[model samples]
Target chain A: MPYYRCVVPKDSVPYEQRAAVAKAFTDIHCGNTGAPRSFVHVVFDEADDRWATPYFLDGGNRAGRSEEVKAELLSDLMGAFREITGVAEEDFSGRITEGPAKWTMEGGMVLPEPGEETEEWYSHGQAAAGG
Target chain B: MSRVSFNCTMQEGQIGEELRAELAAALQQITQDVLGESPDDVPVTFSDIPSGYGFRGGEPSTTSLVRGSIVGGVTQEVREDFMRRICDSWMEISGCTVDELVVSARDV
Candidate 1:
């Protein structure tokens, strides 16, 4: 009963790649859960408003912060997002919303289980300094 | 002992290690409930991070990647309801804020 669907716009992805991800999604999870492929739907939402990015904040033994430093940190994530997702530009919805996001998973429109790891990550992260 | 990093800050008791293990199951269950597919049919995976190292989950996945579920297509009010219910439960275990949350919804 798994239905994997992509919520992406045509402009953001080429048909072939999109299809490939869906297939990969199904191949990985399908049958393992004893569910039919038709039941799974993986969605890819092509968003022009924001891009996934990572910023290194200032911490003695940790990463650094500062616009320039943040830019330096985000360089890799920016490249990775484009390379992996085939996105054309980079823009964080941080301002449109507020504060830049480490990735879209936290800021974007997504739903995972409450006790899920992502929530754990969030709770753990909230405990850390410079959140 | 500071190898991990986090996307946001949180309280220690807010999110727990036990729930971390349960996340993958929860995400799988959520997708399965909406799509009516078996757990295998759910493509999304849930990962967790420990310690105060910061950040949750594993590494950031590339965008060329296509990852999302059908449950995201539910009505806004219904979706909010789902998130709200979960948030209430999550808050007890960990320190997750209601704001700065996102729900993925893409047209297939």
Candidate 2:
């Protein structure tokens, strides 16, 4: 489970840009990790003001992926956010925190580790997507 | 020191005050039943992300997140049971589908 929370100044990001960033993140995450698209959640919250920058990406993903993959994922996600919203590099910052896969449940099943996904997980995702 | 606490976030206006109360009670009950934590001692807070601010798979999101923190770690089986019960009760009380909820019970 990868949940991306975009913490930005109030009303700083319009609906269009938010949608674009969400789509880009979903694509980037799924492309890099081979995870189900439905498992990716992106939310924009304007209530957080503790960040040093006006824009921030607070991401949470299931633990166990390689550090290289995690770093690249963050970089790609931030890149997409900037490219879509035109936010300057200095105005944006982010980090992805991880938790054990066994600790969370999505769609009624306990999540499998990064490389240990079975057909059941994929099928459940597909069914959730109405495919 | 409470043994469990839950932080629930949902889309604004999706659940009414009445339903929220029901959901909170359900969470506490589940905590007590599954983890043996006292319902009165369990802390459950709810927040709303305004509409147009939440998305799933690049579209507007109807999903809600219930994150629980356990003071002492439980086995995988207990964790799964905790999450499953939360998901079932949340969907039943909130009228949301299984796909619309994400439940996590993490050990501290």
Candidate 3:
């Protein structure tokens, strides 16, 4: 479960850029972690004004990944946002928070811990992908 | 104090007011049945993400998220059961596919 929320100024990101960022994020997340593409959720919210930067990526993922992976994932995500939206580095920031896998369920099954994925889980993902 | 509360977020125009009421009542009933939390004490809220504001797998998303926070968390078995019931009832009442929903019973 990797849910990425892009918090930006109101009306700052148009629909085309938002769609591009979402696609890029899905690619980056699935590429970094062997997780299913379907499990990655990207949403844009222009409602929050609390961040120091004009753009922020608020991400949530299932726990158990190494710090290295998590750090790289966040960096890659922020980079994608900037590359797609042409936002300056100073205007963008990001962080990914983790929670236990057992605490969530997708496709009617409890999510397996990272690296503990079963073929069944992969099958569900495949089906959702329309494979 | 209530033992559980749920925040259900959906895409705009996916479910109407009538279905939302049914879904909320079903969630409260499930809380009572699974976790023994009184329906009166269970607080359920629903919000909608405006169209074009949500995406999944690089496409516009029809998915909804149901996040439940339990004060004193239950065991994994109970947690799974709780999520399963919510999934079943949500799909039944809302007519959404399993892939269109994400249910989390987080321990707070």
Q: What is the TM-score of chain B alone in each candidate?
A: 0.42, 0.96, 0.96
What tens digits encode model 2's per-residue C-alpha lDDT throughout B1-108?
777999999988888878988899999999899989889999999999888888877778888999999976588888888899999999999999988899998887
The residue pairs that clash in candidate 3, if any, are none
Q: How would you class the docking of model 2?
A: high
The residue ranges of model 3 lying beyond 4 angstroms of the native Cα positions read none
Ten consecutive residues with minimal summed lDDT in candidate 1 chain B? B56-65
Off by over 4 Å in 2: none
By summed lDDT, which 10 consecutive residues of candidate 2 chain A come out lowest?
A122-131
Tell me how candidate 3 scores on lDDT.
0.91
Top lDDT prediction, candidate number: 3
Candidate 2, A1-131: lDDT as tens digits: 79999998988899999989989999999999998888889998887569888999999999999999999999999999999999999999999999999888888888999899999999998787663
Score residue B50 of candidate 1 by CA lDDT. 20
After superposition, candidate 1 runs with Cα above 4 Å error: A1-131, B1-17, B47-68, B71-74, B92-102, B106-108
User: Each model's TM-score?
Assistant: 0.29, 0.97, 0.97
Steric overlap count per candidate:
56, 0, 0
Model 1 C-alpha lDDT per residue in residues A1-131, reported as the tens digit of each score: 12222334435555455555445544443323322233233343433322343211111101112455334323433343344455555332111111212112332223332223254444433343123
DockQ of predicted model 2:
0.85
Q: What is the TM-score of chain A alone in each candidate?
A: 0.33, 0.97, 0.96
